[model samples]
Target: MISVVILGAGNVATHLFRGFSLAENVSVTQWYSRNLTTVEQYKNEVDITDDLSDLKVADVYIIAVSDDAVAKLSSKLEFENRMVVHTSGSVGIYDLDKKHNRGVFYPLQSFTKGAAMDFANVPICIETVDKKSYPLLKTLAKNLGSPVQKVNSDQRRVLHLAAVFVNNFTNQLYRIGHEITESEGAEFDMLKPLIVETAKKIEDLSPYRAQTGPAKRHDKKTIKKHLKQLDDNNHHKAVYELLTKSIQKTHGRKKL
Candidate 1:
């Protein structure tokens, strides 16, 4: 059985705990959090503790903390030479303290508390200095129903950048869509199907080929109409104009 100790009390940590719980061959030895109130409720379910000195001996230590706190937490760990990995796509794998065997276990998906995660489609990006440890990570990913990907620090960094565009920035655009619909006294839920279909299109066609709408067509009249609609909202207007110009440039229609 692969034993693990998870460090952190946030969304990623909670989700990882649940994922590991489903693995029959996996045993979560302990969970560490600086704040008691955050992880206190989990005491009955698992060995949850606040003291770093009280960490359990486990095969793997997964630091599911923020990118900034990863190094600090790793440094605080009293254990050394144990397989330690941080759950971050942007941060370098070597960011963790050098005392332990450092690695990366990045789940390439946005997580929300209370939301169900089917890791079947999730890409688990992993990296390690030792080749022998690769199988352990691969097994963990398979147990979690995620596809394993061997990604180095630099590749993971750029993958994170693309993820930010596809996930974070896309969510912001959804927020903008929500705002625009609300302004027109329309329900935001109405756009849900459109969003789903737009995402599904990439499975069969390239984003460039699947592209549509005013900007892609260079329909200046429709673009002007959209600009006019957003006239009262300068922030939206600026964003729309910038993206339209970018799309036009991408499709070789940048002359205008």
Candidate 2:
């Protein structure tokens, strides 16, 4: 079995720890956090430590901390030239410097505590400074049942930015839709089927090809009516107008 140690106790840490614990060839030998009391619950199954010196030696150290703390925490560790990897999407592998055999094992998905994650379906973006460490990462990723891809820092950053647009921005739009429905005493659940269908269609069709509604059709009357409805909120009105104009431009139609 490949002994592993995990640093940090946040949502990502919890999710990763759980996932690794279930893997047959990987054992979480140590769990480290600044707060020993908080992680004491896992002590029966794995060693839990607050002090860096108390950290147990392991074949691999996975840093599941925030992007900003990765460098500082890595510098504090006495890995003795062991392999180290971080689960950050936006940060580069060089951020860990020459502290150890540094690399990135960023899983491209949002993690929430106690929420189950299907690692097999998630894409694992891997990078390393040492060629020897790359295969170790790929093997570990495969064991987790995720598809591993080699991506440079530049490409990873671009993928992260695109994820924010597709996931975060879409969620924000849903929030707006929900709020609008609530204000009119309508059940937001009514949009559930439409939302699901919209997402399903995009799996087989390009977003542009699947586009619908007044914006895509350039229906001036409906567009004007929606704009007027959004007039109560300047932000919403601006967003609607901008998106409508974008859809019209995409279809080579003159904006009204």
Candidate 3:
């Protein structure tokens, strides 16, 4: 069994620790957070503490903190020359303190507080300077049932940017849709099926091929009507016009 010490108490850290707890081949030796309250619940299962001096010996140390804090926090680790990894999609492996064997264990997925996600579906992007360190990471990821990918820093950063566009930015659009429907006194749930099918459709086809609606059709009448309806909200009108023009450009249609 591989022994791991996780340092962080945010959504990603908590989710990963939970995944490790369920895996038979992994042992979570310790967990830490700057604030004790964040990790107090796990005290019975693992050594949960805020004190960095109390860190126990482990095969791997996973630093799952915010991007800016990663370097400073890892530098503060009194332990040295141990295998250390961070759980960030955008941050490169070299950002960690140089005293230890550094790498990345980036889980490419959105994490919500206290929400359970299937590890098997999570694609873990691993990067390491030493080739020998790969199999250990592969083993740990596989034990959690995660599909592993060997991603370099450049590719990982771009991948993270793409993820934000698809996940975070897309969710904001969903919220806008909800607000629009609510203003019309209609139930937002009415769009749920459309949302689900839109996602599922992309699974089998490229988004370019799956593109639809008045913008793609270049129907000036419908476009004008939609813009007129959104006139009360200048922000909504601006976004609508911008996306419509983008779609027209993408589909090789001249703007109306």
Residue by residue across 18-100, what tens digits does model 2's lDDT show?
88888888888999999888788888888888889888888889999989999989999865588989989898898885969
User: Candidate 3 — which pairs collide?
Assistant: none
- Residue 176, model 1: lDDT of 98
Model 3 residue 94 distance off true place after TM-score fit, in angstroms: 0.9
Q: Lowest summed lDDT over 10 consecutive residues: which window, candidate 3?
A: 247-256
Q: For residues 22-89, what per-residue lDDT tens digits would candidate 1 score against the true structure?
A: 98888899999899899888889899999999999998999998889999889999888999999998
Off by over 4 Å in 1: none
TM-scores for all candidates: the values are 0.98, 0.93, 0.98
Clashes within 3 Å, all models in order: 0, 0, 0
Q: Model 3: runs farther than 4 Å from truth?
A: 254-256
Where model 2 places Cα greater than 4 Å from the true spot, the runs are 253-256
| Predicted structure 1, TM vs. truth | 0.98
lDDT of 2 at 8: 93
- State which candidate has the highest lDDT: 3
